[model samples]
Target: MARKPGLLMAQLLNRFIWFDAALQKSLDIRGHGGVRRLESMCMVYVHAGIRRPSELARLLGVTRQSVNTALRELEAKGLVYLEPDPEDARCKLVHFAPEGAVMREEALDIVMALEAALEENLGRKAVDDLARLVSADWGEAPVIGKKGVGKAKERKKKSA
Candidate 1:
């Protein structure tokens, strides 16, 4: 199927990266240090309801170093902040600033455009069916992991 259509999953995914990179380029064609990749990626995670950098890395299938670079760029762009984790003093979490929220909203519009293009190319029903199939597979995975959403364990109760 892939060889026939020249659209293997990896190649298709590369196209998305290329598309995103171009979109980012058009957004601000300055340098590689622009407010595109990180903010764009952060918007995806935030839109998907995942804010933590740790979770973002896993969801994006990127390394922590890659995520860290993106986060730093986001910080420089005033799109995100690292707040001290109340639950764990030693840890920290990322949150969207007011401007970040605005950025996210704009990013969502861009995402919608991408989705519309995909639906148009793949056929709306096919995209919808693909979404359902992907969701079904995703539902089987637990939320927490060493590199995912982190440990979701409840606090231990005292013995009576």
Candidate 2:
């Protein structure tokens, strides 16, 4: 019999949690200070050229309020600052402070080192395959409830 889908998903989630915890520990061991995991994730997005709060929220799959709260904490830590968006006065752009730039660079270096270690432990091909699988599009989401499925079936019957 084929493996259950739920089992596979659970394994994947477990690995994600393990990796997250390991990365946090690695950061702390490197004396990078106590940067929150969410803050580091947001910084990665910022470094990748996502500057707007709304855009970060979309990329991170979180609420704008959540992103704003993280940004505020980062700002208070002197890691990020908000400025008026030149294109849109009603919006603000998140930028790294001078100290934040240094910290970002160091964090990136540490992440790269950790990835290299993971590649070594897992084998380069296996690591690459896992990356590809996660990045692949699995298709649109399925309708969850019986009521939604019934509505879909009704629409299909009407069309037919």
Lowest-scoring 10 consecutive residues by lDDT in candidate 2?
Answer: 141-150
**TM value for model 2:** 0.77
Tens digit per residue, CA lDDT, model 2, 5-98: 7699788878866766776787677666777767777888898899999999988889999899999999998999999999999999999988
Give one clash count per candidate, in the order shown: 0, 0
Candidate lDDT values, in order: 0.69, 0.83
Deviation in angstroms for 40 in model 1? 2.6
Candidate 2: where are CA atoms >4 Å away? 1-4, 139-142, 145-160
lDDT of 2: 0.83
